[model samples]
Target: MRVEIDGISKSYVDSAGAPLHVVGGLTASIEQGEFVCIIGPSGCGKSTLLGMLGGLLPPDAGTIRFSGDRTATGEMTSIVWQDYALIPWRSIIDNVAFGLEVRGVGKQERKAIAQGYLETMGIGAFANAQPKQLSGGMRQRAGIARALASDPEVLLMDEPFAAVDAQTRTLLQEELLTVWENHRKTVIFITHGIEEALLLADRVLVLSGRPTKVVEDLKVPFARPRTADIAQTPEFGELKQHLWERLRDATRAAEWAEVEGANS
Candidate 1:
């Protein structure tokens, strides 16, 4: 579903009881079935924005409009968080079916449906295994499977692959792309990796430091079924360099501001 974020803003009170702005008048449009990645310096409220989009948190100001009334917070959107958030005590299959269970789906039906997603994620064999028994990458696959089981109109992923190792991260990226191609789900992915953004996103939205707003909204022109070799292309390298510089500069500026605040 298409999502339009209009004049959205948020802030929180710091330890010193001063209001600290996180996002400011951030507006963007994500078309139906579009894969959009938001990149910015650390602590710039990227995750916070994702939370608002998912309807887990409300914006302090402004509105999030979804075409056809599919607000991000409803069943139209599901989020796969960085921590996986799977139940350690439950079997993988049960965890994957948890949402269905909450929706009052029959046991047989939920398990059957959950298994379908597990097989899709290539984790069917681990269906009965406890989460702790699986490797980090495998656990993340299970997490994605669980999200897919919910069959959301849009997937809001907050650093979903950030916990995995490099090789595993690349593999997950490829697998995710394959799934996206097949299902064509609207995706809003938040990340710190410039190359990761370029490799997976149809468009990349760059944000500045705290009180963050979009600094750049770049469309990636690379052909789909993207592979590792795509990263080696000169055009890919140039875009990556440009995004890196933007993020680096924002980070440095935030650091200087923090130092000055401390001295004052």
Candidate 2:
């Protein structure tokens, strides 16, 4: 396994200063270069889990471990946030090279590396263009370019395409598949969209509501080089229905538990 998550738990202070548990004893593992997607009901700490996985936040208990050629130095993980987080003032190429520059690489070297990624992302022509000049999909391509330029061992994405239109989201999903095919980086993607999860992941982990855990772990049976048309197949429909039922039951259980606690 490239990543092993063992009994990971996290809590936060609520608005009333009460301790709110978000995740509890969540355990799973991602194989080296495997792509996994996580889906859960709203407010189920999906982003919080991604944060912990990316080492952006520390868990209150448990651990996330990386093995198999992962290094102590340099960035082993990079994130693509939903908002695209581009530097509006910088050109697209500069934005992609931002990480390398921060590591003290020479401007020429960073630009060359960033340009290469931009080309791979099919955004090389926009290298000199400002972020504001690009469309939502184009800007997101730049964000992906930025993350890949770091040459991460694992890529963590928190709903990176949520802000785009449906058509554009589909296009970006295809783009992501193309990129992943080339680099084969271990990816842990978080999304609310079930179909998107099914389409992209080698496996899908469904999470429970607050105080979340893995409610179900489903291996995607579809072969690689998948297309949107797969969603229409009977097998895809079957899996989707099963996942929906599991998620519905998990959500209902959480709501019922909350209600019972309130009454008690």
Candidate 3:
């Protein structure tokens, strides 16, 4: 679960033939079983960085290497996307088992494994239901269960709770902590929610505006089993305010990143 991200950067060529930089010289490391969150302003390349770490996208100028025995190539990763991305035709249980099916696991075996995560994610009741039948929060939980059922060593989540309502979002955040506590997988979650990162992560990586890089990598001193209760406490407010101040500067800079030459 140990990951070394060394000087990673990424750029996309725009329609007008300019290079649009996303990540820029971002370097960091994640110890085994650590829950790491990357917090940033919107469009700050947090998900781009996560994509590189997951081996889905190549960095333009750096390396992502896993130096741990727990996972070869970093323990095989599962990504919980912002969009639920469930198969409309598949039942909930079948959808959760989809990743395992890709790896050639037998149906019965995969179903057994999927069943465990479905219960863990609190969506086992929806096992026979279709994605269309579920609420937004329930669908997200199913998406998470689908990822966890594979039992990967690393879980990369890209704003998994953002699409739901605020109350449902809060509930989902708590559910995510429970799952993370039990699994202890090395997790790198991408979110723009300052408080969400503070509540859910062991450490937070704050990224700068586009051509994004690490602005701050601060460890959270909060105790385990973090809940909404902690959110109203003095400690929580202090951390929240601190992160907000840091992000306020980044937000101003985020506007400049939209210019064509950052693409150029």
Predicted structure with the largest TM-score when compared to the true one:
1
Misplaced by over 4 Å in model 2 are 68-74, 261-264
**Which stretches in model 3 have alpha-carbon errors above 4 Å?**
68-75, 257-264
- Which candidate model has the greater TM-score, 1 or 3? 1
Residue 254 shift from truth in candidate 2, angstroms? 2.6
Report how far residue 98 has shifted in candidate 2, in Å: 0.7
Reference-based TM-score, model 2: 0.95
Please write out the lDDT profile of model 2 over residues 1-264, one tens digit for every residue: 389888999999989888889999999989989999999888888999988877788889988888933322348788999999999999999999999998899999999999999999889999999999999999999999999999988999999999999999999998899999989999999998889999999999999988999989999999999888999999999999998898888889889877986697
- Ordered by lDDT, highest first, the candidates read 1, 2, 3
Alpha carbon deviation, residue 174, candidate 3 (Å) = 1.1
The deviation in Å at residue 202 for candidate 2 is 0.4
Clashing pairs in 1: none
TM-score of each: 0.96, 0.95, 0.94
Model 1 Cα lDDT, one tens digit per residue, 77-119: 8889898899999999999999999999999999999999999
Q: Over the stretch 32-116, how does candidate 3's per-residue lDDT look in tens digits? A: 8999998888888888887887778888887777863322343388889999999999999999999888889999999999988
